[model samples]
Target: MNHLSRRAFLQGSALAVSAGAVSRIAAASLPEAVTQTQAGTQPPLTPASGRPYQPVVTLNGWTLPWRMNKGVKEFHLVAEPVLREIAPGMKANLWGYNGQSPGPTIEVVEGDRVRIFVTNKLPEHTSVHWHGQRLPNGMDGVTGLTQPGIKPGKTFVYEFTARRAGTFMYHPHADEMVQMAMGMMGFWITHPKDPSFMRVDRDFVFLLNAYDIEPGAATPRVNEMTDFNLWTWNSRAFPGIDPLVVRQHDRVRIRIGNLTMTNHPIHLHGHEFVVTGTDGGWTPPAGRWPEVSADIAVGQMRAIEFDASEPGDWALHCHKSHHTMNAMGHEVPTMIGVDQSSELKKISQLIPDYMVMGDKGGSMGEMEMPLPDNTLPMMGGQGPYGSLEMGGMFSVVKVRAGLARNDYRDPGWYRAPAGSVAYEWQGAAAYLPSAGGSRPAAPAASPSSKETVVNVVKPAAHKH
Candidate 1:
């Protein structure tokens, strides 16, 4: 059966009995269970400092001709952008692959001879870095390290066998930070012989992304965290987009990857995912393993499978809170109408309170608007600003278990696309005092004039 249909069935079963309890657990962080393996002597993989694994894939973009009669099962990728989120209600020109951020997820089986032809569409030089697959040096997509970066308007072919069955990722190793932040990462999964053990009722993948935007501008900017503007799942934010969907009671597999310079500790609500595979290969013998959550590093991939025994709109997101906002919040002291610099510090001692707001009882009311409760940020190595001080990046994954498409209910106003970061923008809109006064009459002019007279515009929180 198709994964989606099976997912619906399981979700429905889960919802009938434990909806309330599951809902309660959706947002709470459960403690991880630490145990020794059968040998009882080897150390377990600690969450703090697990050894880093690498995966790699080839990338080239080219049009397939009818003359190319044979079907190409193995594939490579190039991360580029055709559309981008610049600001609330604005899309911009940015770099990404396959017309979106977080290039497409690639799934394969072990021992398959994967052949990938990469065609370069960008005007500049770039290459694809497989995060954790151990291939021969020639198959590595390093620009200068393994091979020269693919030039614009060219194609490179990579051939390799799937020796590993696990979760891995791909991205550009050249200009590591900037290119990745611009949306060049995606999830990769491989299944080995006897794939039945890896089978599941549902499968989902996500590529997490963060954007830095300038206030009042339509497009997000480059990698200066101070000006970072928005966070997203896959590509878009919430409320302005759609949510990831799943059916009840389905055995689901979610392949997650982080492509940016920073690491992401992804958490799923209401359930824990089994870390069945890593970047290099499958666990000694792939089967269910106990792990409530997993930390996915930059350019790294992790394949996690879980049973959807509980049904509800579950949240999946990163743990860093600051990574969820648009660029405006990143500026130090983050405010206007106040001069906190040395030039104005003497004349504006009182203004610092309004500008920073950090001095007042540990709060910045607007920036602290509550994220959807069930969702949390993945605070693995650093917070949003690369240190514990700023918090970390985060997002939400909504799991609608057991409900068939026809049986599903609208999950309120905002929903995000599968595998992307999401944000809340309610505080960004202007507000008028609720003075218990009568509604003001429309001005004797165009609607624009009435809006100008009242200074009230509709509120819309942009989500990807």
Candidate 2:
């Protein structure tokens, strides 16, 4: 191969590193999708009030005997009383991990041994189980099946080697259904030993699950899988959770785990991800493969890495359509069929802002309410009045910096960058149209014109 071709090949190989690395291609290598979009002078938005993005991290809490730190982390399971208007202002107890439902994201490195000390803060006995970790049977954290449950206030530590790198999860093993249902799950990501294999521009962790809420209430109802009411990422439903931020040309790594007793086949538009790791362990690079969607089973975790090289806002959600919305659509009927269908439609048409997000591609309705009953109030305590709303959960991953305008579009058909106001894309495409339109008109060639006569008179023959 010639020098130029050899250099090109090497560059392409670098872009394929499992870790987060931007893929830089010559303008000529630009895909047809990219060439169609035009670049604008403005940059994407940078919110002033927004919190600095924190990578989602998960830790395991289990009780075991033998090695140091036991095998678990301080996995605190608590049941707290919460007030729900639907329950007539009565307080009901909800279960959670580390005092919060949807648990926490635990991060570690591949091949590193982990020692977690778990303390049961709740009234009942519970144990932590490392979901998808292939360890000695004794250190698995199974309650009656693996070891005795840890009594309240007592701490148990479980230790084990994280053989592979991928998305893994942790939850209470005792009364698996009840405990997990009340929000006892979280996410984990294992990084590779060598930084080269782990370098990434951006990394995100998503813990997706659903909750059943009693009608017109703020609290979550317990254990109704058939009638699951709300879907959430990292415990906060859409609208309530914040957008995942990113820069254009960034490489992103996302680890998804399902603790909601259902399988979530996640889908992302624009670019595909490489399934570099699985629950069993990290697959050898030669065996690693690429895919656009993946089915992550309950109590299961999977790791995927992709290039955010494409700009614009991309939609990342569960393939199961219902999983994108609250337990159900609004109790009230649509305007077209309701008592004031005409009025509602008119108001929606005239006032853009008044119309709630009707049944669109998916329902991020629950995001308008408070965190689930099983979730801890602390993590959800950021927004005013300590409540999380849309624009808080299920965040938009900004590929590049600067204010996102309609004109600056990535090759990917990402929705327009989210506006400062909430729910601007209620009916419009995910991204806002560029200042003029999707494709900017090439600058009209300067009109042809005759040259002007020389106006500059020689400086009086220069009096020297």
Candidate 3:
């Protein structure tokens, strides 16, 4: 027989053996009409509904279709290979669910019975583990323990009731070391039954993933555990990640899941937020406290809520410097105090392109060193103040006062109010002390003095 026929025959034989007598008895007991209805009728699946909650648009977005079967929501997730872009110039071959790395977000309502069907299209066995969810032991998706793994070309089903509403995730429990490193993961969000409980105007969700793909390479080195180079918010690095836009004064909730080897201290500028919930569910009012940053460890999730009261473009990124860089050399020696100038003078005579780096300090990020094809600089980008010198795991949150509640478009940069922007000092007022302390004698008012005085000063610019 041909390859296709032989494979089909083998699969059928395996299923018959696997099913044994229980399958025959169950099939025989079902009435013909009931069986026909079950086979022909399919319910339509609707997106999780919570009025006034704005859906977050995933960068390079994709999502699975769901259907209601006998009041239970059914979702099909296929595990297969995919090509994913990390940034503008870099793309990698990865294994994920439904054609995207860090597979699509699965959103459902709490207390709903859901059935998820996972088909293994991978080359080897695989299983899905619902991380941080309370489910039956048999449906835990642990290969060879809770249940046998789904072999290649086979399918497995996991049915459970989403008892608690929180931010969670899913990944392969079988061969996780290799599977997860290859980018096989996705986000899971269970909204509360009561829409008003812990409600927000905008709900954003994303997974933090890391990879160690070498420069110019198209696939991640699955063997590397800790020394990952590319840090991503959703398998996409900075400059490629879409900004989180919200209307001024709107309540916002951002749910972040971390699957990388190291922890990420996610920081948001210009605002302090409360840790409203976690993988375990909403934090008690007493446990909630204001914070500017939240640390999410590997295999953990954090949900933070804040009011978009300020109108500006604020930064949201990991506080770890290296985590903000892409493809950085971890072993590069620190030359901050070392002077390679004298030696470089002779080297430059033979090679005109040779140049010294990190001599005085703060020059590493400023150097225009050549990088490999399909690779990003360790630190790069342009900002209002000049070179942003940032990469990986970084994005902006744009808030505007007149933005429509439903509009999620970027509003460009913020415009400063008159006399509010920092600029080079033109010899403004020099010093000031508390009203209780001694003060300088009042000087005669000049034409400029009539204008409002700004106490800001510009420090001397440093040389690289």
Candidate 4:
């Protein structure tokens, strides 16, 4: 045989042997990669075959199921393209693991040995970094730094001991900007060996994520960092995100991990909480102070605990007002107290969907505006009373008096008692004394004033 033909035959045989090896490895050693397609929160996965510990509820997400193999907790994660529903009317094409973005929460004991098998089904190579973990240098999962990137159609294994008991996260260490921007992330919890330590009646977990998709597009602009249009918790927006249900007077712990570029000042109404844990570990009791709002910096995890004393639906959301709004209101011009009625008819002739924002402020939640395909309203979600005027990073903490111990279902809206709500006064309005004596009245615009006839945008036929 010729030398070139012999070389080609040897290479082909080697390729065949490698393929057989990979197939044999998958068939005999790999665990099943469990996946879920629904966006709603799944039931907490109780310890099926591992050390006993209370499982946590993942808000708008679920706990990853693992199997015991030779004394090690085995988990399989498959990375691929996924279609994530950001809200009721909007969906995004993103990359994630196990069939969802902000993939399932992984819970393990503090001292247990863990093995994670990552199968790459993406178009490009990827890697998984166990954020905030103290593992072997080679098991750190940093592409090229700790190990080579897991190429497409390849499976890699990561082994480590759960050294810390706190809130941590997992995401790609390779092509981080694009992968994270495409909605790749998940939550991880290392439970203390003593289950009684830092115990709570109910515990919740989720990740804060953001996206920069256009109003009508399905894919995000992965290069964007600051000007994100969609702010989410576990890849879900308000109204779509399930409420954090808790029993009244019960101790609750909400573990939040921020993966977005900016900080989130998470605020809760009708109650105060204290930071009890972080990525490092449990916070010392003396270092904690009560706060109505806690600021979580980028790539940080914060676990806040509080007693659910209130009985009504309380608002829990980001303090940055812009973060709560969806697309299409960031570049709007201010027209408060301006007379644009004359120009409305002229503009309406040219455009059919131009909407003038409300007079009191910008877009109103109750306003019915026309939107492009695959787009959500700037302000959305209706409450029993009226429009909620909220979109992203918003949810309710439904504290009820008679909730079952394991009940995580929505209990509907809360009803206030008689005379508890504020009513308008029918007599006279009280006036605050001016700091600089009597307030001067501004001059009214005349018929011939230039301000009375300024050129404005054409109004859309749709009402705002």
Candidate 5:
């Protein structure tokens, strides 16, 4: 037979044999399996009596469910193509796990043994590296170093005990440059042994990822390393991002994992927090310090905790201004201090829409320039004051008093107290005493009432 015919015959034979074996096994284990399934439907394992910290992490997304095999949890993660929406109008074709980019968060309790089966559905070979995980040397998942790569259409199993409890992540170790750039990553969280040790009322988790896709393009350029334009949190841009909601005085923990090329200094307005844990493990009380912003480096994870004392809609975003924008053009020239008004007037004769911009300073944020379809403007958003002028990797933390402990709904915008808002001065002007010790009269209104009048006299013209 030819090569194609022989390959097809072999695949068919294998499938037939696998199906027969499954049928036999199912018939033999039917009774035992039913019992086990019934038992598995019971409540999940919980901490011993008096433990304060229960696992309350709101994946902020979703979690991967597992099968209970004996005493071990079995999870299946399939790496395949996915069409994910970064925001309302922007979507990209990416490679991720189990049909979603930054695949479902895997939450397990400490001391539990887990088995993860990763199926490679991509055209190329792939392997998953458990970032910051401690496992047998042979199960490290590094291609050629610890284990062989999982060839396309093949699956590999990784078994390990959850030794530490902290924030962690996973991504491909083989062709990492291409796979990670294509958005193959996921969050792995292990709950502490003593649940109440670091208990918090609310917990949020997300991954920081970047992509280099040209405006209007659907796929990311996997080769570009430093010039990424699409910055995202959980592969989502701002406005599309769900705000973090909490009740006043609630203890909150936010875990951030960075899988991008560069580091990000995540900043939070109107609050202070401390780095409580990392991928390595939890930080001791003595080792912790307060911070308004924390720098998370590539392949690193940081967990920050704070008390939601101040109630309002607070901005939480990357401190890097460019990181908070989408499809930003880094190569654009600076037009500040350049006189383009006269040229623009002439150009408008030919193109009626032509207008001069940035002559005094950069005004891209204020201008409603046209952008490609399915692309977000470099800076955009409306705020109570005016334009928020921000995009990617930005979100708000809505804290309100009297919200139920378990309520995670956004409470809408906060209303500021009266007389606190800044406004333009328009009512009247005050007068001061002159050098003769008498108050100067206020400026009189113009006779026409259509224009205002100035009381000061003009200086004499100089003859140079």
Candidate 6:
């Protein structure tokens, strides 16, 4: 039944009845709820049965597949407790829809009528709020205000027409704080009616989410507020987060939604872009300004467009330094520039695992310290040169030329032209004279002239 086409599945429904109101159908005839188990960035799900439009790539996530029935696009989401791998070695017990945390992205057209059936499997009540949508009041999904909470084992239906062409999000409005902390959220994109409107060669979408899972623990602290631990993009930390692959000179648009408690100043390297859209709607041509970064605040969505003009593995990450680090390192005491050799030896006698950290700018990315089970080093990711020393909310935008139009595969590392890469200087450390000519040494003035001049120059040190 899961693999059946929309027509076939609807025809084979167990309790098929007259289609007076599709939303009122018996549970036995509900649309199949497709779920995903693999924790990877799935290929964009192209429209198999609806108005044709460009689909978006969800970073480390996938879009929900819907069935078209009677001109309505239908989707089923199952809410339940699930295990979500935050990265390669760490898994968290979270509650999400259709299998993963920060659930599968939902994509729709601007004027499409959408019918979503939600089946609750969690112990508590839940309701999906279509954030930043223009919809009927009764379908708003706020518990006790618009609709009652969907109790465990109960299925609820929400039908609405997507009236806006913009970016949006969906999350629980019932027990909002706790459920969101448990990762019950997802991305939504209502593409414009015209496929060419604001079209780009590549479009990528993801959400900023965080958790308060303690080291060696698998469940988030639902009550924690500002003291969160795992800062993630689409529930994945750096290294575990896949790169945004684009063909060179492609028109690229990245839609980002912030569901975390705080804001994230997302920065991109090697290229500049402009804000093409936001939660409210697409920006007019006059309103857009070129920028390399955008600060997305809580409950906000932003779509930035850029041309992948350069070919390289350019960095794209959050500007907040701590937001780019993993859990344990956040609370560690500052030990930079401190000599702890003798102290570490004394402490090692009592605690055999004692080790010096951050002295002489030590990086946890290169440390071999044994960590508690199910945790990540604060700053750890491998790059072509050496340790990236980065974690959380970071990834590379690999722009390469000659790639297939639709290809999103990692192009591996970029190969720079001869002498293009920065290298250790083999020449003198002192500044050299300008190529035109060494200016005559500043003329010396006699004491009686009341002024004397001397030239001083400083060499610059470049770091990547």
Best candidate, lDDT = 6
TM-score of each: 0.57, 0.57, 0.79, 0.86, 0.79, 0.87
Residue-wise C-alpha lDDT for candidate 3, range 269-292, written one tens digit per residue: 999999998888889999889999
Relative to the unseen true structure, what is the C-alpha lDDT of residue 341 in candidate 1, on a scale of 0 to 100?
58
Model 3 regions more than 4 Å off: 1-62, 342-354, 363-366, 428-464
All models, RMSD in angstroms = 18.0, 20.9, 12.3, 12.8, 13.7, 12.1
RMSD of 1: 18.0
Error of 4 at 228 (Å): 0.6
Worst 10-residue lDDT window, candidate 3: 32-41
lDDT by residue (53-117, candidate 1, tens digit) is: 12121111111110011322423244444565322234655576554455544555566555555
In the range 1-464, model 5's lDDT, one tens digit per residue, is 11111234233212111111112122221111100101000112232222223543333345555545555655668888877777766788998876568787777878878777777899999998888988899778999999999999877778899888888899888998899999999888888877677888888888999999898788999999899999988777765677788899999999999999999999999899999998889899999999999999988899999999998779999999889887878887888888887898899776554557667875455665545567766666555454567888998888899998667655666665544445444433422234334333333322222111111122234455
| lDDT string, candidate 2, 1-464, tens digits | 11111234233222111222212221122111100011011122121111112233221111111111222221122323222111111122345543345543455556766655565666778888788777889888889999999888666656677777666777777876666666666556555666566566555565766666663355556656666656666555543443455666666677666777678888777788887666676667888777888888876667788877776556666777556544354455543323545666888665544444333423332233233333222112122112222221233444655534222322222334334223323333423575333433223322222221111111122233
Task: Report the lDDT of model 4 for residue 265.
Answer: 99
lDDT of 6 by residue, 1-464 (tens): 23322345335432222233354557456777767767778777667667888989999888877766788877789999878888777788999988888888999999999898999999999999999999999999999999999999999999999998999999999997789999999998999899999889999999999998887789999998888878999899876788899999999999999999999999999999999999999999998899999999999999999999999889999999888888744556777888888998899876666667777774666666656778877777666665678888999899999999888877677766555666644354333555443323332222221111111112223343
Question: lDDT of all the models against the reference?
Answer: 0.47, 0.49, 0.72, 0.81, 0.72, 0.82
Report the Cα lDDT for residue 208, model 6.
97
Looking at model 5, which ten-residue stretch has the lowest summed lDDT?
Answer: 32-41
Model 1 misplaced stretches (Cα beyond 4 Å): 1-81, 86-88, 218-220, 223-227, 240-242, 284-292, 331-464
Ranking by lDDT: 6, 4, 5, 3, 2, 1
Candidate 6 Cα lDDT to native: 0.82
Least accurate 10 contiguous residues by lDDT in model 4: 447-456
Best by TM-score: 6
lDDT at 443, model 4: 32
- Name the lDDT value of residue 240 in candidate 6: 79
